[model samples]
Target: MAESRSETLRVAWHGGDRFEIQIRGHSVRVDEPKDFGGSDTGPTATELFVGSLAACVADCAERYLHRCQLPAGVTVTARYDLGLQPARLSKVALDVEAPGLPEGLRESFTAVIRHCPVHNTLFRAPEVTFHVLTSGHEAVCHHP
Candidate 1:
């Protein structure tokens, strides 16, 4: 049997081009840079996207190394480029730095990153749809 879980996040406009994001019990801010008429208080959507990918890969790499009995620190940095014409992601470049990685574990670490959730997700893109509520009934929230 396979098991799965759901993830949900909420965001509300915070005046100007800033938004308040709620994930679990934490609050984060998302906004555009000052040159784009924003307060530049936090990372923009593009930054979050690339940042998530790096974080995901780093986490998986670290876990895989430790499981091999060679625990080491991992750092991942991703650079993104904007595609023209339609304005989409053109390319993503990632640098994985593991200063303490064992000599024989390079191949295994590379393989582990290949299966990183975020990296795999990019390999097989998921469906993304937009919905707008022109008119709808008031919804109630219930929490425990």
Candidate 2:
């Protein structure tokens, strides 16, 4: 059997329906509906997805601004509208505010936005597969 390129995350129930996720040396506590086997505290999975998107965009914007020799005070604000029923993401908007930037820097920044990994991934649909692992089981799969 071959090892998988993807990473494995371990999750354990802390108490009162809250779960602790161990990934990349970080521990994240997550909970959900009180009756749905989770605590009423913390954001839901869908909300977390949007949160990840926002964080990725912010990181990209900050890195781009730093690489472009911009000032130290650059900020990005992002918001999203989620659709009901199907629970799909409807729209995502971003506002960039930077001080001490040259006159035509907005265009350069917009160009960088097009290359953001999260934005690109959201726009493109990639194949996704799920595997259930037991106590000492391993699953290997390839992604094209």
lDDT of each: 0.87, 0.73
Instruction: Give candidate 2 misplaced runs (Cα > 4 Å).
Output: 1-5, 13-17, 33-40, 133-144
The top-ranked prediction according to TM-score is 1
Query: lDDT tens string, model 1, 38-95?
Result: 9999999889888988998999988887887675888888888989887788999999
Q: Per-candidate TM vs. native?
A: 0.86, 0.70
lDDT of 2 by residue, 1-144 (tens): 276376688888878767777899998777888777777777666667777776776677677778977775656676888788877988878776767567787787777766676677887966889667777867656876
Worst 10 residues of 2 by lDDT: 1-10
Name the runs in model 1 displaced over 4 angstroms.
Answer: 135-144
Query: How far off is residue 144 in model 2, in Å?
Result: 31
